[model samples]
Target: MNRRLPTKTIALLLAAALLTGCGAFSNDNRVDPELSLEQAKQTAMAMELELAEMIPDENVASVDQSQTGVLLSCDDKRGYQWTGGMNIVVQGDLDPAALVDAIIDRYSTQELYTAKSSPTPDGGPGAHVIGQHGAGYLVNQSPDRTAIEILSFSPCFVLPEGTSPRGNF
Candidate 1:
């Protein structure tokens, strides 16, 4: 006697094998969204410290942490009198769309700034706000919906005459 597996069972088995092989359910990139605002601030500070290590020559002028976000300002050692600053905003437990919309609404009302919204790679909402100068603001949620980061860079900062800014990106 000969027996054959059912089509539905075969299909389901194949799908399971494929998914396991592809690691489609992996959470390697997932972040814990349960972090409190203070924890997020500490994370931002840790990031700043990492950046400092990356660019040791730059001097950190100030760091400000608040309920909204953390702001870090640095001086480029070139003596060009330019200030480089970055702001990081962390949003926890809010829907991605609502977070992005709030960021857009907050910046849209400001003068000399242009706000544009786009879809993030993970299907989340993102916004980019540009000021009259070279300053820029970026707001986006993580792929895992763990948190949102809003980054802003100052316009006064610029590379020295001979240095290339391309590497900064």
Candidate 2:
């Protein structure tokens, strides 16, 4: 004769699965509020400068963040229309060539989409990190229908130590 599990066991198993999928069992459920445009820019710049000083570098040349709001047109009323974003760029200095390789190596394991070594007009080695994310299209004209994209590009001589790396979301 075949022996089947009790009804209570099946019910408990289903409940546990549902909780796991819904993230209800997560330890931390807090979400940080969104930052204003000006705040975001300032915070990003400070972080960039901090990173620049950590590595072995002479000085940070420039640190800037760009932000943009865009509205695209779609063929249908519910068609896909994505908003564009701003790009951030940062430049700095380095004495020994090996330090450049070290920074790139660490960044390779981060949230960076693309990292490449390029040349600057002033005869300096420029390293860049680029990332892109789709905000998705809206199905209805909801009040919260805007998407903000943050891009940071800081080529620092020295990177910050003991400081966790952060990027735009």
Candidate 3:
């Protein structure tokens, strides 16, 4: 005769295995718990300096604080048809991959939101998440930094009726 485990016992075993495999139940506190808007601005400013060096002709138009994070915009000195901007979210030193995963998971569960892994502009790996409202987020993580950049367009800024606004990527 064959002996089988009870249904409840099997379910418990499966849950345990999943939790352990994904470390979802583990108390690993590697992520930084406190991340403030001021700190994020500082980080974004530094990043902007680096970007300036890369593109000497363009200048940062503005830096402003938003409800969720900071915003940085590139000036349209070249009289370009579109304006480009970036929204930054900085969290203190944390595992970038894990942070990206967490954000993706959080958005994936929401209605009208999509999240997926994307390749960074520099050929590095990153995450890209978007909402139904035309707002989008791009995340990149390094050893010392974790940041999310939002790319959005203002309809009023576009001219000629069909030009697409530039992105901060």
Count clashing residue pairs in model 1: 0
Q: Give the TM-score of candidate 3.
A: 0.35
Q: Judge candidate 3 against the unseen true structure and give its global Cα lDDT, from 0 to 1.
A: 0.34
Clashing pairs in 3: none
What is candidate 2's lDDT per residue for 1-169, written digit by digit as tens? 2122223422332233233321112222221234233343344344334334444333333323233322221222321112212212223433323434544455546663333442222233333332222111101001121211122321111112443223322
Per-model CA lDDT versus the true structure: 0.37, 0.28, 0.34
- lDDT tens readout by residue for model 1, 52-145: 2321122222323222322222233421111122322233334557656765676678775555675554456766655432334445544444
Candidate that would win on TM-score: 1
RMSD of candidate 3 to the true fold? 21.3
Quote model 1's TM-score: 0.40
Candidate 1 residue-wise lDDT at 105: 75
Query: What TM-score goes with each of the models?
Result: 0.40, 0.33, 0.35
Q: Order the candidates by lDDT, highest first — what do you get?
A: 1, 3, 2
Per-model tally of clashing residue pairs: 0, 4, 0
Clashes by residue pair, model 2? 54-159, 55-158, 55-159, 90-153
lDDT of 3 by residue, 1-169 (tens): 2122233432333243233321111122122224322443343344333322221122223322232222222223211111122323343444456656776676678785566765443444455544321233344432223333332211111122343334322
